[model samples]
Target chain A: MFDFDATMPLMAVQFLLLTAILNAVFYKPLTKALDERDAYIRNNQATAKESLAKAESLVKEYEAQIAAARKESQSIVEKAQAEAREITAQKTAEAQKQVQTQKEQAAQEIQQQKETALATLEQQVDSLSRQILEKILGPELVK
Target chain B: MEILGSLTILNTFTLAELEVGEHFLWKIGNYTVHGQVFIVSWIVIGVLLIASLAATRNIQTVPGEIQNFMEYALEFIRDLTKNQLGEKEYRPWVPFVGTLFLFIFVSNWGGALIPWKLIQLPSGELAAPTNDINTTVALALLTSLAYFYAGFKKKGLGYFKKYIEPTPILLPIAILEDFTKPLSLSFRLFGNILADELVVAVLVLLVPLFVPLPVMALGLFTSAIQALVFATLAGAYIHEALEGHGEE
Candidate 1:
């Protein structure tokens, strides 16, 4: 059997060397990569959450705009209908005024014609009487 | 025939004394290497790597038996590391810590289970490398180096600052403590496994009855505990490296 006293230091040195080499080559890079990967994932998750929130707010804004537009359009339609009814009422009143004026003129014209006709008839009757007296007197005087 | 049979049983339980470098047949110039241990360690590591790879090869949602068992193991180690080191820093160390725990655990158990004598390689005997102080020390050194490097890299000159921090009154003791950390880490594993192996060998020779069974069970328990201790300390070291002199 070999003596333990002789080999102890050699063993220690070898172990120390092995650990140093291994840590440099293997351990450090692996850990750094892992850390980077974790950071990337965290960043991605944060971005996704932000986008999702933005999209949700955008949807709400669109819905609000649509609602406001619908309300405005409904009010516009109501105003137009009121204006049309007012115009129709104004035209009907004007037409009624014209008919009243026409009716009064026609009545006046009829009354005037009747009066003229009466006067003419009286004149004609007077003429016929005169003619009849002349004819009777002339025959008597000549006899 | 009974006598021969008893001799065979005696042989079966015998522990062979093998030299570290005796099995090495290759001589490159003046140097002789323990090709057996190298080959054995290689085999242990390779087999583990290959088996685990195979287990994970085509991962199934509703896994096959092997995949289920392996995934369970991997997840278990992952949880342990996560608990010890916290999730953020623990991810990178998972494969290393996982492999270390598994390799050690498998090797320790392999030493107990695989009858090296039966294989009869040209080598005197073969066992799990972790059973040896050299291999365990290597493992400990690797862990020490890991945390030390982590501390240095994470804090630079501040790594030394930690040795003297809180108060100058504590500096010398802290330095000594830092020096002893790896020693403790290495010996803790080596001492436990060596003792367990020795006890099993002794018990098999002395009392071949129900005694060795309990001892073997204890050995298994110790093996697992040792692996856990090594892994936990390694995790704590990494935590200390990253955290520095902060309050827990």
Candidate 2:
């Protein structure tokens, strides 16, 4: 079995041929498919990450807007409430002032009417007393 | 007389007979070729081709069964080549290393799995191509040529500078190493495969029943390991050739 012959070179050539054939048929296409799939997965992952970041930013922006709007609404409500309280206070003070003037005027008018009635009663009492005296005492003696 | 009579009976009865060193010769032009080796080598080639074709037929991103298996094999080869040849230079060498691994692996397994004895040959019986010294020598020689080519291509004439590295006295030893590399590579493979076949054959001959099964199983295991060892060593040789010897 120690024989050496042309089979060595021929087998080498056969193996080389196999290598070439396998390179063309097996290695090239399979590696290309593998590379393409790798690139596809990487591309999808990158885009997914980008979209997630975008969604997160949008969420933050909306939250900020919501917070600002809430603050603005609260301020507006407070301002309206303060304006209502101020207006109520002003209206109450003005009504009280008007009532005070009207009360003073009525009291003054009643006092003046009472003084006139007392003066008239006093004049009537004097006239009645004078007439009673003229009737009781004789008119010939008084003349 | 009794022993002689038993020997004759054993010879005539074909009780686990082992044949060795026989070849079916085929003449082509002026050179004689081993027809049995070619026959089995062609079968190995055909199997590889059909499997490759089936794997690449559809070429889907989501691979089917055959495609997945082929891809896994390719990835395995890629990793092996990359580990030996490094990341940068490994890509171009993948096909060569991959072919070596696939061819040897399938040939070995095929030899063990196929019932070659059933088909009677005119001269020698069919067996694994690697079991023949000629085939292993051819493969080892190819590895030698590949590494030399890789060295020459990468570093040009400077590849010869490795012979005299550290000291000029090492030149003869380095040159001797070149010859020994192929010798060892070829003999290791040839001896392992031949011994495995012989052990199984002898076991079967001695005990013609269930005793050879475990040895045959071990033979299969060794066959696969041999294929891997051959490919890994070949890749390592190429890598060594490509690497600069601290002179860079």
Candidate 3:
């Protein structure tokens, strides 16, 4: 049953030929396709992860910008309210000053008129007393 | 009457010989070749080639049925190569290992399924190519060459240092292991396949009924296992050959 002939070399050549052919047709192309698929999947996953990260960062940046804008708006509203309050206080102070000045001026004018009337009455009283004294002396001399 | 008639038929040298070694030898310019082995092998190779060409023709990322099977087979062989031959240099060995696996697997199953006896030759009949000692030996020899080549290529002159390792006392044994490796590899496949076929054949001859079905099923199972074993061992041998020895 153990026979060695040219069959060994022949079979070897046949196997070698088959191996080469199979590598060309089967193993080579099949593995290439499989590997390409694997690489494609890996690349896709990487791209998805990158895009997700990019989106998250963009969202964070947008939120930060919104917060900054909101703060700026709040600051602007506070400045406007403070300016309105200062203007109202200044106007009230000016009005109070004008009322005080008018009261003083009116008091001064009334005092001046009262002073003039008193002076005129004193002068008339002196004149009347002198006339009465002259009449009494004249009557004593005739007796 | 049936027993006598069976005996007469058996003696008349007709219908599945008990001694199944006879070959329909072909002489080509003073060279002889086994025709049955050639025919069956040609058929197996043709099937593999056609399937491979068709499935690989378009080369899509998403697989069809044939592509799926082919890809799975390639993935399996790749894993086998990477695991056994280690990660660094297993890529090149995948084709050889895959070829061996596919050929042997196809042959064993083909032998079991095909009614090769129907294709009557002048003397012998068609069967699995792996059933021949020549084919198995050829496969074993290829595996042997692969390991040795891997060793020489990786380590250069340092490949001989392994035979004397753990002290020179084990030199003979290590060398003997090399010879026995191929011997066992070839014989194991040849014997198992031959035995399975013979058992199924004998069962079919005796009972000629449902009894042979289980044996045939077992044959198919073992055929697959044998192919796996052969490929795995070949890969492992190459791995061992390629292993690094840090210094002298």
lDDT of each: 0.67, 0.90, 0.85
Q: Per-candidate TM-score, first chain only?
A: 0.65, 0.83, 0.59
Per-residue alpha-carbon lDDT of candidate 2 for residues A36-60, written as tens digits (9 for 90 to 100): 9999999999999999999999999
- Candidate 1, A139: how far from true, in Å? 94
Q: Determine which window of 10 residues in candidate 1 chain B has minimal summed lDDT.
A: B16-25
Pick the winner on DockQ between candidates 1 and 2: 2
What order do you get sorting by TM-score, best first?
2, 3, 1
DockQ of each: 0.07, 0.74, 0.51
Q: Candidate 1: which stretches are off by over 4 Å?
A: A3-143, B1-32, B121-124
Better of 2 and 3 by TM-score: 2
Worst 10 residues of 3 chain A by lDDT: A134-143
List candidate 3 segments past 4 Å from native: A83-143, B1-19, B244-248
Q: Per-residue lDDT tens digits of candidate 1, residues B1-248?
A: 24433544666555433333335344556554444445566666556656555665555445677656666676677787898789788877776676567767877777767666566667435766565666677777677777887788777977888766678788889878777887787778777876776676556656656788888788888888888888888888878877777555
Q: What is the lDDT of residue B83 in candidate 2?
A: 98
In CAPRI terms, model 2 is classed as medium
Judged by DockQ cut-offs, the docking class of candidate 1 is: incorrect
> After aligning candidate 1 to the native by TM-score, how far in Å is the CA of A42 from where it should be?
17
Error of 3 at B78 (Å): 0.9
Count of backbone clashes for each model? 7, 0, 0
In Å, residue B247's CA in model 1 sits off its true spot by: 4.7
Docking quality of model 3: it rates as medium
